[model samples]
Target: MYLSQVKSNGKQYIYLCVYVGTQEYSTRKEKRVYSFGETKKALIKMKRWKRKFNEFPNELLNLGCGMENLEEWIRTIETGITKTGRIFKTNVKRAVF
Candidate 1:
């Protein structure tokens, strides 16, 4: 899944897109849902949604890499500080969750 931007009627909007079908079979079609305005905010929202729903593609999870990769993905989306006030940085986006 990825973020898509579209322009229509002189207005630009961002949306979240996911491919249709399961890991074994793909219809080669995309389903776009959830429109947002700003790119950064949209990304943040999408990351939160993805994490909350465990929206990672089944193909990736089924690759035998298993939960290790899944945990890595989650780590990338989450960033904050511990009780010691030390910052935890991730190579991926800095999400609030």
Candidate 2:
């Protein structure tokens, strides 16, 4: 199973929980971001990976530290254009509706 959540800091994180090996539960997750999904799935996936490697991979996940598309974000910010930007802009339309 897979699960995801948006964090208070405005980041999206995903976790996977599955029984991939002899283990009955497993879990995988972003290192930092939203962290520790609200469900049991995350634990399940971790167990699976643990069983597969017999140890942790000893690597770091993106953990949602940087924007997934930093360049696109930069372009939008530079152009002062984007759905979110437009919506949040201070304008007459926003003041009325």
**lDDT leader:** 1
Best by TM-score: 1
Q: In order, what lDDT does every prediction score?
A: 0.48, 0.32
lDDT of 2 by residue, 1-97 (tens): 2222333454333332333444335353332323344223333334444345433233323323222233332233234354354521111111110
* Model 2, position 4: C-alpha lDDT score: 29
Candidate 1: misplaced stretches above 4 Å? Answer: 21-28, 38-97
Worst lDDT 10-window in candidate 2: 88-97
- List residue ranges in candidate 2 displaced over 4 A: 1-31, 34-36, 54-97
Candidate 1 TM-score over all chains jointly? 0.32
